[model samples]
Target: MALLARRAARRSAASTKAAAPPAAVAVELSIPAHFRCPISLDLMRDPVTAPTGITYDRESIEAWLDTGRAAVCPVTHAPLRHEDLVPNHAIRRVIQDWCVANRSRGVERIPTPKIPLTPVQASELLFDLAESRDTAAAIARVRALARDSERNRRCLVSVGAGRVLASALASLAADGETPAAALEDVLAALVCMTPLDDEAARILATPTSLGSLVAIAENGSLAGRLNAVLVIKEIVSCIQLTGNVVEELVDALAKVIKAPICPQATKAAMVATYHLASSSERAAAHAAGAGLVPVLVESLVGADKSAAEKALAVLDAVLASEEGRTSARAHALTVPVLVKKMFRVSDLATELAVSAMWRLGRGAKESEEGEATKCLVEALRVGAFQKLLLLLQVGCRDATKEKTTELLKMLNKHKGVGECVDAMDFRGINRLS
Candidate 1:
């Protein structure tokens, strides 16, 4: 209310101000002592001529009208107003001269500053020594880079020469001669490993390398968990290597999911498991044996929105698998949660929820016994159809045209969709009853 009143007052005052004729030529005016307001310390807005043949600003005049004694200056607390500011022309000239002196464009405006070394560049220095022909020189450089913190130096060296060393060691493994430096090279790389997919897979394949990577993951480093995900994508069948890698991956993922620092890594692990299950029979059995699906379902119903999203994504991936479609037959309660989340989640999550629900609905339709079909239909009616048509008229303008069209068709085929569809017609508009 106060804000509205002030705006009204300003507009009223501005309308009454008289306009002056345009100047025939450009004329510069120096700031005058009488033109400045003592209260605001700014050029006065509506100056009035005084009886003493001098012009005084509004604030100075206001102070004099309030009291007959000396008025305090607004800018400086010194006592001086109408009486002290006696139309001084000399002070105005000094201010204009000072302004003119400060006006210029020159070399003093350069803004460049001294640059410092980046950690990446420092890491590069360590790797450069690996290419040197002299072994002693290269090892000396590695030692210097490692310094007192062997982990830090190893991290740099692993990222740099780590791959070349690992490949060389892999070649030596075929010949049955494991050099002492081979394990160290792989360990160094694993400890310093970035979140790259290829490096992670290589590190996990070696038993010694896997132990080192696991240590990093358990130490709250996240590198081990990251490596586990890398290996998951490449496992084709249930060989000796596949079983060991899967066990390690599951163990590493369980540890990661429990940590507060990288729940996303846990999500990644679940997603990789989902993807693997879809492609391999052995993987499906392994994942189910590890109790992955129930854990993922719990996360979907969990409190955290981010974790729920990841869980849902994993579920979505899992549903695409033959095992997932088969498992959905037994879990009747899952459909309701997926339906409820469609509207409750973020925009992307909403789309994912819709997609997952649609797939499950279609999959259930194919079943002869209509497994979970009634519950899914009820969830869609209460969860999606209740609010979805209304949303089509509000935001979400860019929803995929075909998807939206398909949903509309499905809604029309639904039992209670008549009420929602009637709400959009001309006569029924705004009259939901």
Candidate 2:
């Protein structure tokens, strides 16, 4: 009876006591009213000077001034003095706790996802852009891509994404943007590329296949059009990418080299062809087919020294090739142009001309040799020897000096050594050295 009575009393006590109020959940506020109170808005009282020699409000002065320049000091209306101010370190700690508590409400600044494009979609866009028929739409799309900051930002995040790169390259090609503008972007994407995507190859090949890049180099009026140097460099890279696009490159270069239209463009084209000649055999064949030798020979007499110099360089490069030998013979060229160019001596023109002449003179038939040799001797006899000897004296280390030596030796062997020697005396060649 005593145990049951005790159990009942315990049950009554548990039921009679109301459940204690649920434990209060603590809520923190970040900016307290005191800290946030602007000194400019509050009245200053009992101002005391700190080490900075400025008086401020005593009670809330230091607290309000804690955030440097966030509020004016209590006494001064100017911006709160930064040096005299100190941060409320405890506020940051409280903020950390508050952030931890409200993590679900925190805004995460995550990067936006890019509009994912596929290889097929990228290729289709490129195909449309590359078509000559849709040049306007293609250009508009490219301009839009350039202006679309959001899309570009997302693209930057997905730099190595093959589809994005293909689309970007296609856009650049379609717009015909200047090389300087497009080159850096393309190179950046290319460095990150994992494998050359099929879309990338197709888009890249589009321009090379079109053949107008060379034409533009040949005669583009656009302000920053791709020049000959850049064109050849790109074609070389394209050759590496496309494998045996040399034929296409050759045809384009030939077209530019042979285009008789714009002299500057022609000069630029020849310069490009000279660089290309440094690499491929097809350049030699195509240059010969396009009648490059005769054209350059004509440019020698042109008024523009720049064009003439470029022409001479190409001629020199051309004569070094086996096809050049055939071209030289088939044309039955003369040495008068060579003689005139040798006297140029402006830059490398004289040296190139002399070298080209030597190469062309290689293993000439007896009759051809007689004709050239006779003309060369006549030039010497007519007081050309003095200038040749003077050229030898003035640090002529290239083909000019060597050719002079050969010509002097040849004159000696023409059984007219003594007569030529006497003529040299009259022309002051004997006194030059």
Candidate 3:
């Protein structure tokens, strides 16, 4: 009886081991070979066929091309003649069917991939939109197209659709017509024109077109405002602005930043401000006067690293002129905010913050009993001297250290606060002494 029980136990143990391999095998069998991308070795979400007769995910293949690797088929190693990647619809349908059949196994259906817009199709769509009397339908269609794949966006730009849309916007503005729906659609399409070419940017930068965008920024829907700001940022990056245009741009950016729109729009506004201010001191002063300094100081209250860095950079640019320095000094939180950011953010932010402080300090020393002295007093009250001592002791970039040394000397001269520096117990202060 004991021998029989041991034999039965051995048989059960062998049977349990045999059952374990089938679960993994079943999982392996569920994924069809054709569904996998050769490049990524995963189930393709958006498969396209290369000219070499092998299918791959569109994004994966685009990244492959972007890397400038050998122009050979990854699978068959055949020399690729052309880079055209056609959608493999048959395989996609098969994969969908397989997913449906496996629904009981918790397999989710892959969404149908959006068809990319071709240049011809984009041109025709632009013409239809231009002539369409149904404004709502046109807006919906434009939004859908803009939200589609990246390839469609590139095609829209290549087919001159962006220029046509800008011209339409210009005409609308010239006639003093502001159909909210149509304007939103046009602005959204312009945003989709990533890498807006010089000509497209020039068209959008015109006074009429730019004013339309500003109007959208002021009164359009949140989506419209976000897209407008983004398009403006892209346009500013590609072109140079001067005189009234720069002033208008800065004003629009300030309004958007002050509004309760989305974070993306705010970030876009901040970036646009930085770009415009960096272009020239005139633009920087204009931006500062447009309530940019106070807005940036408030933005730093709870800003992330990237946003804080950008804000500091814009502040630095704005502080280059006497007017900009005056504007910054007038803001109650300017010195404390910059002092707070000195070492708390990135090294780049530290450098920019230090430079801005140096400028403000230099301006204060040159003053008799004016706003500059007030700014200096504000700095001291905010513990700017103590923070500067700590920054020197903790050690920073070489340039930052040098600027900190200069700022300390200037502050010491004004306040005669040599005891403040003497009270700090940092090693770097000893080096400074």
Q: Provide backbone clash counts, one per model.
A: 0, 0, 0
Which stretches of model 2 miss by more than 4 angstroms?
1-230, 233-244, 280-282, 329-334, 363-386, 398-400, 410-433
Candidates' C-alpha lDDT: 0.48, 0.50, 0.76
Model 2, 211-286: lDDT tens per residue? 4444444455442233432434443543443334445555566666556545544655676577656455556655
Model 3: runs farther than 4 Å from truth?
Answer: 1-30, 67-71, 76-83, 111-114, 126-143, 279-282, 330-332, 364-405, 408-433
The ten-residue window of minimal lDDT in model 2 covers: 20-29
Question: What is the clash tally of candidate 1?
Answer: 0
List the RMSD of every prediction in angstroms: 20.9, 28.2, 7.6
Top candidate on TM-score is 3
Best by lDDT: 3
Worst lDDT 10-window in candidate 3:
424-433
- TM-score each candidate: 0.46, 0.44, 0.77
Q: After TM-score superposition, what is the CA distance of residue 177 in candidate 1 from its true location, in Å? A: 11
Model 1 Cα displacement at 92 (Å)?
A: 46
Local distance difference test, candidate 1: 0.48
Give the number of colliding residue pairs in candidate 2: 0
